[model samples]
Target: MLIDTHAHLNAPEFAEDRDEVISRARENGVSTVINIGFNRETIPTCLELAERYEFIYAVIGWHPQDAKDMTDADLEWIAELTRHPKVVGLGEMGLDYYWDTSPKDVQAEVFRKQIRLARELKLPIVIHNRDAHEDVIKILREEKAEEVGGVMHCFSGSWETAKLALEMNFYISFGGPLTFKNAKKPKEVAVQVPLDRLLVETDCPYLTPHPYRGKRNESGYVRLVAEEMANLRGLPYEEMIQITGDNAQRLFRLPARS
Candidate 1:
């Protein structure tokens, strides 16, 4: 089986056919999914989906783009949701300098707060970073994110940055972009990162892989990521699925035997 470690299955794109999208993922051999919460508005829906779907799990926190309009109450509310039985992690949070929809300072401040929250709650984090590697790395280190180790979703960084994150015990997760012929960094990260410290995701409803590059994405496409990982490691497709699936279970503390 495969696990799609990062996905926005709760987004409006899946609103009309959400059930079918989820069904297809199961039919395609994806046993688990981590639904990401990118904003205050999506928190409830993220939790609700985890409750409604046997394979769905939730990660509640705000994305950098969504942080501009946030308030103290929003953070407090997310803290409250951290106690939910199905809330396995606390983020999709980090920096996104490419589009400073939120000021860099605000992003850093919120990122630090989320890191502290994750530690306080004893849940891991799911970070999202883009063109902000330096600040992201500094904040993560300063916040002592290693204490609550997590995955770097859609990780887009040089091998050096990846190595630093790995040294901190963070799993380097690849997404659809890895399958793109032009995506050298992710492909390079694929080759360098060890299988145990490596993970695969669809980041669904976005970054759809090659054949489905311009199409709407779903968790089912994670099989493509698994195939890509296997190709990178020269292993059989089945092994990639098993290893990454197990990695996901271990990272999220899921009751895999259950």
Candidate 2:
């Protein structure tokens, strides 16, 4: 079975037929999905979905873009949610220089706080980096994030960056971008990321794979990302599915089959 390690199924894009979307993913061999909570509005919904579905898991944290809105009390709230059995990790957090919705300093502060919280809770983190690779890597290292490593969700970085992340005990996750025709970098990184340190995701409701580009993405489309990765690695599609699924299970500490 394959795993979509990062998704946003709680978004309104899935409101009409959320059940059907998940069923389609199951039909296409995606057995597990890690739904992310990016802000205060979506955290509860994200956890609710995980509670409702045996194969769905939640990663709750604030996004850097919304860093200005999160408060210390909110961190406590996230900690409370972490006690739930289905809440698998923390984040979708990190730097986002591309948007600059929040000041860089504020984003960094929030990111570090979450990193410390994840360490305290003994949970993995799911990072979201955009146009701030250097700062992100710097902060992660300074914060000693390797103690409780996490996945760099929808990674769009150079092989050099990936090498550093792997050394830091983090996994490299490829998403819909891996399937884009012009996405040469992700393909190059896909070929080099070690099997044990590789993961696949859809980041659905965004970054739809080619042939379905510009449309609303769902977990079912993660197969296209996996197929692309398999081709790049010169491995069979099923083997890619198995290895990536295993990677996700190991990172999130889920059951072997889940």
Q: Give the candidate number with the greatest TM-score.
A: 2
Off by over 4 Å in 1: none
| Superposed Cα deviation of residue 232, candidate 1 (Å) | 0.7
Q: Rate the local accuracy (lDDT) of all candidates.
A: 0.90, 0.93
Which tens-of-lDDT digit does each residue in 1-258 have in candidate 1? 688999999999998999999999999988899999868678889999999987899999989988788788988999998888888998899998888589999998989988998889888999899998988889999999999899988888999999889887799999899999999878887898988987999998999998899999889999998898899899999988888888888899987644
Who wins the lDDT comparison?
2
TM-score each candidate: 0.98, 0.98
Which residue pairs collide in model 1, if any?
Answer: none
Runs in model 2 deviating more than 4 A are none
Q: Write the per-residue lDDT of candidate 2 for residues 143-246, one digit (tens) a residue.
A: 99999999999999999999989999999999898888899898898889999999999999999998899999999999999998889888999999999988
TM-score: model 2 vs. ground truth? 0.98
User: Lowest-lDDT window of 10 residues in candidate 2?
Assistant: 249-258
